[model samples]
Target: MTRSAPVPAPAVREMDIDGEVTLFHEPTQTALVLNETAGDVWRLVDGERTADDIVRLLASSYGAGPDDVRGGVEAALAQLAAHHVVDLPSPG
Candidate 1:
């Protein structure tokens, strides 16, 4: 089964300070601070690219193999989903 691409929540507002990203979830009144790598991941969650695409892109940008950064990228996506900053689509 293939999962749909993740989408940033409509109520989530993002701010980039220097390179780090701060996300504010309006409905939950919650905030999440993302590190550089996580910020990159957040920016790419445009309801288009799948998680695997994100992993491959980041790995290539960092000069590492996809296997090397897959875990961290997946973890970041999970964390964003937990915070309601991004809505992860269910497997179909």
Candidate 2:
């Protein structure tokens, strides 16, 4: 079984307030309070980018290695998936 790419769920939307990006889930009536890294990840979830792409993008932005970035992104994605704020692909 292969997992597909992840993207923001339909009920979620992004907003920038005072230079910070925030993601809100309409149905859940919840807003994710994100750090800069999480905000970047939220913005990058456009239904196309893979997890590796996210790690690479953020890694380059922070001038850090991809290992830690990959772990963080994976954790964030898992949390988002648990909240149903992101659409995790079903395994085949």
Maximum-TM-score candidate: 1
Off by over 4 Å in 1: 1-3
- For 1-92, candidate 2 gives per-residue lDDT tens digits of 55567878898877887888777889989887677777778778877888888889999998999996888898888888877788877766
Backbone clash numbers for all candidates listed: 0, 0
Cand. 1 TM to true fold: 0.92
lDDT of 2: 0.82
Candidate 1 per-residue lDDT, tens place, 1-92, comes to 65589999999999876767999999989889998888989988999899999999999999999999999899999999999999998877
Q: Which of the numbered candidates is closest to the native, going by highest lDDT?
A: 1
For each candidate, what is the lDDT? 0.91, 0.82
Instruction: Give me the runs in candidate 2 sitting further than 4 Å from their true place.
Output: 1-3
- The CA lDDT at 48 in model 1 is 89
Question: TM-score per candidate, in order?
Answer: 0.92, 0.83
